[model samples]
Target: MGGSLPRSVDDLPLLPDLVAPQAWSADLVAASDGLFERGVRVLRDGEGGLLVIGDAVMRALAQDPAVGGTPVEFLTGRAGDRVRRATGAAPPSGAAAFDAFLRNQVFTMNAALHVAVRRVVARHLVPRAVLGMAGHAERVLVGVLDEVTRVGGVVDLERDVAGPYVTRFWTDQLGVPAGAALRVQQLVHEMNRMFLFAPTLEDRARVLAATEEYLELVGRTVAMAWERGDNALLGHLARGLDGIDLPGAPPDLGALVAANFFDGFHTVAVAVANAARCLLADAPAAERVRRAPSLVAAAFTEGARLTAPLMLTTRMALGDVEHAGLRIPAGTPITMAWIAANRDPEAYDEPGGYRLDRPPRLGTTFGGGARICPGRGATRMLGEVALRALTATSVQVRLESPQPGWVPGSAIRRHPAIPVVVRRVAAA
Candidate 1:
């Protein structure tokens, strides 16, 4: 491996078949029920990773006053040689590997550069993203529905309406070039599978090549946006605020763009679709949101709690850690099951139910601690705005197929297509 990015052989292993039944199931998280119900708080996976579950461990891992702030390093291994070998750079077994690792690390999650890049980029993205969802939200969503109605009003909900809406916001508000959002999303996702999840070396080689192509494409896009100097997120990073480069040079143009679009595309899109799925599943619930517009955010939050868009995250123990009776050795790879943790019965009255009245900031849908998702506010806003706009119309929202299911990607839970039929309601 040239760079050290793959999490584990298991995380994003090449699928045995193209599509798994679990991916198409009504309940996406159902596959993990047994793991979630294990009597022990921590279970060892075959790959030597630790699986943390239930209310107690989740609390300790996420929010224990004493251990809550413990540093869990991001997953990266000695793939420096791999990157060097793959990219054909002169390298021996010394600093070459480390340097290669850092180079590859820059564009990925849990990078040394992540903090600085996020600090710079969020300052620009957050405000505009909120504004896009606020000011142009109605217009943006109207556009989505119009597209939905155009194709006979029958869609897989996820691929058609929910998926496109995220890119539309990026293009319309974030200054991403028109018609480039889809391609950008495609490239970013290929990278994201490597960045956020684990893939085999063979798979990594294939995707990493595409990810490099993505980086190149985004780099060019960022250059144009930088020259334009628009107030969009891209411009802000290009403007170079927050002393981003200093101490260490700032991330390259493509990494910055990858930071924005890669995660933004599917995470928020799946979340929006999840909200729509939850809303459509219950007429009364959708009606409640329609009646009390303010609760739209709650609907999105609830949907995320049930169907986490990015279900699990890797956290490496900084040192030997003990919480209650469980002892986690230092340097152990701990997989935080946000989905299982969110659904832990101890945390919620009815963990699996789609009720929108839960306490605010209830779960790790957007992560927690130092690594809390910078775009949570924006994600919620996007979902709320999109859902609000859709429900505003008197259209029937239902499952597209007789048996609806989620698409298979353990790293990112999505529906290959959640078919839906939207017909106008008859006037009284």
Candidate 2:
């Protein structure tokens, strides 16, 4: 849901070449400040095109009379059809078109993974395991806290804690093959590298190769589950890949598995790292969250809002439409800067402040409308469990460095590596 791009906007290049992760952060802050005081500002992109970055513009686009329908349709199937008709090309099947659409844009695996993981998570075996693992993770993290006092130094949260938790959960609880889980971890690391720095052709090749292999691993696992006649697994798989029509109705299991790996492991890893960074930045907040495990959800939501594991969302205008007095012709690309929307002062109080007590509000983190993230519940569950584990453990964390930065891709926002020191607390 968060991944689709409108046909009109597909070819439009909205992001600058020097798109840094911090770039949007700055832009969002400026936009928020300006919007609060002066109303909406329609800035022009580098190519003499208009770009709307204010909350009112986003709200108007989302709710105005001219644009009131489904917010996501402009970037998905409907928009694709419009583009095909305009270009005089054969209309591709929805599933095939969606697949192709994702390949061209950034971090579309989120949508693919939503389909894939939900299949697995909805399975009796997997969901049970996930819930059980959540409990186990809480215990493990709490145990780690108990041992923190012995080390009495900073620890790398990702390597020492987050990575290990994921590795253990996927391998032991989820029943994924041990080797595959390890490879997934490696793939996650590689993705982090490629996303953060400019990689050479060889490096890109290596990452893609590993990605394919990991997908195959997941495919095998899903197949095994299906062989066991897991109804939930089968149903989830069928619905998630509903748009994809295979020969004799056999699912393109490989593609589905690949999508899962891309969406599941990678984004969660980034979210965990960013959450930890946020905790370190505000020690009091960390302590508060640790004491109240239920606040885990709030912390995760806030982290996602601030860091936005996925950054930019794109849509194409279905027809020539005038929005807020701006002429957005048919087949034009529209880049919805979710980062800007989440930080909009009008929607959020103290737009820049990280407050866990904020009301139950939906942010653009999982997106909005029909294309909203289906795996939202599971993602929140994962964050809650992981945070619970860390907080329960008697682990002491100290930020050893300055604010950990993010690597900005056209779609996903990730931190390269956040180095911190964690030590076990000795028994009293």
Candidate 3:
């Protein structure tokens, strides 16, 4: 098993120094593009790990559970312990429970447990179930666009449309009280800060606090659904848990529900904003989508490929694995640069441009294999509804700036607020 392969990922040639963080934010695609342009498929991540590019390598590693296993504290177990071990300080008060809660999350589970939980969750997000919600998504988006029409002028797409639309959709699905949905959304947002690449001590504390509140709300919502005998998402989860006969303690139903809901909600919100920004940046594409609604799905696919909402997903080498002529030592963390893989020149012709003609299943934006995001179908459906609704209107939408103003974070690609001018146009 040990011939000419490099002993460690660090032995691989490293990319030259990266630009400052602010510069990376200015052009989110530049850093990955630069690395890909230099023919650097593997490089040290500087955190004693490796960053991998190229679509084929990423897809292979992602599929092979023997090689790539989730190692992120946010996804796996003992986040609090890791923080304490790293900083030599006691973690937040709820850190232990929070970590335990995370361990039961679908992304963190392994083998049979992961399969069992995913089986329950995937049934709800399948094409049929997601299609059943299409009318709801369209109605919600149309209502938002109607409001945007009423409040003509400059509009923040993230704030005015994506945020509210996604929140409403999830809240309605989860059966949260109308008066409490906004607060639930706020709690989820706060809980999300813990995902930042290097969250501050304060951020960790806030996440723990927010997790408690979020779980409480979710529990109450699910209980209410059960009381009313409604088929809300949480109620379905509750019923689904009863049939699972996994070894060890029963899974934390509330944590599973909260984690899954937050993942779907947060990613979809960012995807909607990012896709909108991508669509608005290209006039001809938007007009094409406007003329042919069927093209909206392709537009969303192209947009997700270009924007890559979830940029980097990490995994630890479960065993010494050789790939692309280099050996990644066991225990070394591998960061799959999804954003870079999505834009790989070898994989796509003109990878940077947003074009709808790209064939289906072309990118790693939604991930691949076992961990391929189960919410992908829902994300595509909702994004298509949003783009279609925006195009169906007789309003002119123009970006306030050529480049999107991003939410300052190293974790995900998201625009905090996509400001645009929306002026009413005469009906044709």
The best candidate by lDDT is: 3
Per residue, candidate 2 scores C-alpha lDDT tens digits across 1-428 of 01122334223334343233345443444433554454443443443333445555654554322321223333344334433544555433323423432342222322434334444434433445456546655664554444544555565666556665555454333345556766767866665433322234444445455555555666576566555655344445546556543222224544444454455566665667676677558767788988887888888888778766755555444467665345666555455566667777667798778888989986877655434554555566667776655565455566777856644322456555666666555667
Once superposed on the true structure, which residue ranges of model 2 sit more than 4 Å away at CA?
1-52, 56-133, 136-154, 167-175, 192-203, 228-250, 319-322, 325-327, 408-411
TM per prediction: 0.77, 0.68, 0.88
RMSD of each: 7.9, 8.4, 3.5
Measured by TM-score, the strongest candidate is 3
lDDT for model 3, on a 0 to 1 scale? 0.74
**lDDT tens readout by residue for model 1, 278-337:** 787778888998888888888888888888888776666656666654566666666676
Residue pairs with backbone overlap in model 3: none
Residue-level lDDT of model 3, residues 1-428, one tens digit each, is: 11133556667655446545555445546777876676666667655677777777788778877654464363534456445654667666656546655666676566777788888888889999999999988777767777887878888887677877888887777776767767876887787776565456677788888877887787677567667866666667777787788863235565666667776667788888898789878888898999888999899988988887778777777787777567777877777878878888878999888898787865888888788888889999999888887776576777887776666655678776688876667888
| lDDT (Cα, 0-100) at 327 in candidate 3 | 75
- Please give the distance, in angstroms, between residue 344's alpha carbon in candidate 2 and its true position after superposition: 1.4
